[model samples]
Target: MAIFTMMNSLAALLLFLISSSSLIAASDSPFILAHKKATLNRLKSGAEKLSVSIDIYNQGSATAYDVSLNDDGWSSDIFSIISGNTSTSWERLDAGALLSHSFELESNVKTVFYSSPAVITFRVPTKAALQEAYSTPLLPLEILSDKPRESTLDLAKRALAKYGSLISVISIVVLFVYLVATPSKSGAAKGSKKKR
Candidate 1:
């Protein structure tokens, strides 16, 4: 009878724990996360450009409404828009949903660029207040100076690709010249025997 009572107490404790955990999970609201990245490209006309990509993700259990992304972080005079707008808005972002935005920018002047974090704002269904989040900050980018230096391995690979046929032709020519300039010992021996 004592063992039966202990089993009942253990089952009650387990039920209580499970119920309380569910209550805790039900109170959670929507969580918004944002990420931003910029990449540099050199144009055929010797112009430098930047491509910016932004991603917004809803990671919480609830949906986010009136989701907006703003990226007016750079000076307009310095960086002109080549394509696409810097900001966008959406009606709703459901839980575990992701949205992406991209834009191209070009700068003619030679100067270093310092970018600011993008702003993301959304309204949660459960709350009256608006929630805001900032994207991760990026490092400074050099416009005139090459933003990133190439590795020696990458440089060698590019050089070989561009000058591969030239190198091959030079190697073949050198081999032919060596064979024509140097006489064979067998030819000399045969000539000496014929003369004798």
Candidate 2:
């Protein structure tokens, strides 16, 4: 009978420990979600300016502490942070909370495509762990020129400049046709004199 009692107590302790560990694991994990949007403006001098906005969200049940952002692979020469910071700190972010930041960058227009790396760091007290999360692959920015196209009149002027002799000959032929089609006073006077 004592042996049976001891076995039951041991089983109960094991079950309690398992349940507590599971609860701690569930409450200690933090999930971070991030997204980015970018716009590119191409300049006439073959340079481009990019504007980017990043949004971060805490989706886990625990609060995140000492939250900060970092750039992973972006180069300083190729990108300049004109408007906002590449790294920022937040005291704490509760679950379901959101943070947003914007950055403006300039680079040569020759770079057709680009992706900037973003990393987020936070601390979870329940697990006593410092964790890092990366943003999903940023959508690439494509530079496009909005230069005005040449008009039909402009094209004709250019063609005339290149083929001046041919156009002049055509103009003379058209003038001769006009004169031959219209009866002139001199021709009529000569014809009357001949008839007289």
Candidate 3:
């Protein structure tokens, strides 16, 4: 009975350690997804300034330190940071950092603009890294709009069309009232004779 009890206790402890380790791994892992936009809405074929924002969340017990993003021309020269508890402005931040960057683009900027993959590398301490992997996969950026054309008349027409039904009903009511209130020829002549 004593031997069996010892064996059972050891098995339980092993199970507990494995479950805790997997939980920690999940918490430390990074997940990233691309934001897509239409092709027409892409910037003009020239030097343009662009700002890119990325959100990073730390769900693990240990913090991620020395977070760095590697990309071609896609990275912003200046970075602006925001998170649930704080806000910061920096080109780079250490572990547990969420940052957004803004930068000027060169004329030949091709790879980062399209559906190209962007690599972002970050590190956690050996303790944390072992518990949960510090690296995340490439996240692609998509253009937000398909086309960039604009027209004043189109905007006005769209506005009118959106409220078109209401306008039509009001217009019909006004026309009916006008018809009812208008004096007939016979009534006008009678009023003239009465005045004389």
Candidate 4:
């Protein structure tokens, strides 16, 4: 009877362990997705610039902790984060919530085409999480160098549109000064006839 009782206790312990482990795994796993969109613009000085926008979405039922973008693949000389924070201290993203960030990168190299991938890492919640992290696959971004050139006529038209009122005022002032300085046409003709 004692042997049978020991066997039953072992079975109970095994069942408890299995149930507890499953519960722990469910609570410690959070699902997240990262989306990236980039726009490339070439400046008038022939420098290429990129504006990148990132959106992170949490699809699980748990909140993500210490979320941040990993910069292992990004080179500072090639790309710079002009805006947004890439650090872990930004904020905790809740379930079904979305976090957005924007960055501007300028490259001196002209007529270049390249692709960069984005990786995001975050922590899952636990009783004592201890910074256990998860990462998403590399989100690929394509960068193309294509900027429309402004012709000289287009530049002049823009300038004229911007300063049209000021130019008109100056022109009116100059015309009034010329009229005051010179005699009238009729008076000039009469004076010439009298001289004759």
Best-performing candidate as measured by lDDT? 1
Cα TM-score per model:
0.62, 0.55, 0.33, 0.48
Q: Considering lDDT, where higher is better, how would the candidates rank from best to worst?
A: 1, 2, 4, 3
Task: Give the lowest summed-lDDT range of ten residues in model 4.
Answer: 130-139
Question: Distance from true position, residue 159, model 2, in Å?
Answer: 38
lDDT of 2 by residue, 1-196 (tens): 9999999999999999899757755875667888877778776667788877778888777788998887545567677666777778788888879988777887764544667668999988875668888876766555554548999999999998999989899999999999999999999999999998
Predicted candidate 4 versus true structure: per-residue lDDT over 1-196, tens digit per residue: 9999999999999999899757755764556777766677767776667776677877667888877765344566666666654433446888878888766777675434444446666776564543433333333433344447999999999999999999999999999999999999999999999998
Q: Is candidate 2 or candidate 4 better by TM-score?
A: 2
User: Who wins the TM-score comparison?
Assistant: 1
The alpha-carbon root-mean-square deviation between model 1 and the true structure, to one decimal in Å, is: 17.6
Cα deviation of 132, candidate 2, in Å: 0.9
194 Cα displacement, candidate 3 (Å): 43
Off by over 4 Å in 4: 1-28, 80-88, 111-116, 127-196
- With candidate 4 superimposed using the best TM-score fit, by how many Å does residue 176's alpha carbon deviate from the native? 69
Ranking by TM-score: 1, 2, 4, 3
Greater lDDT among 1 and 4 belongs to 1
The positional error of residue 136 in candidate 1, measured at the CA in angstroms, is 1.1
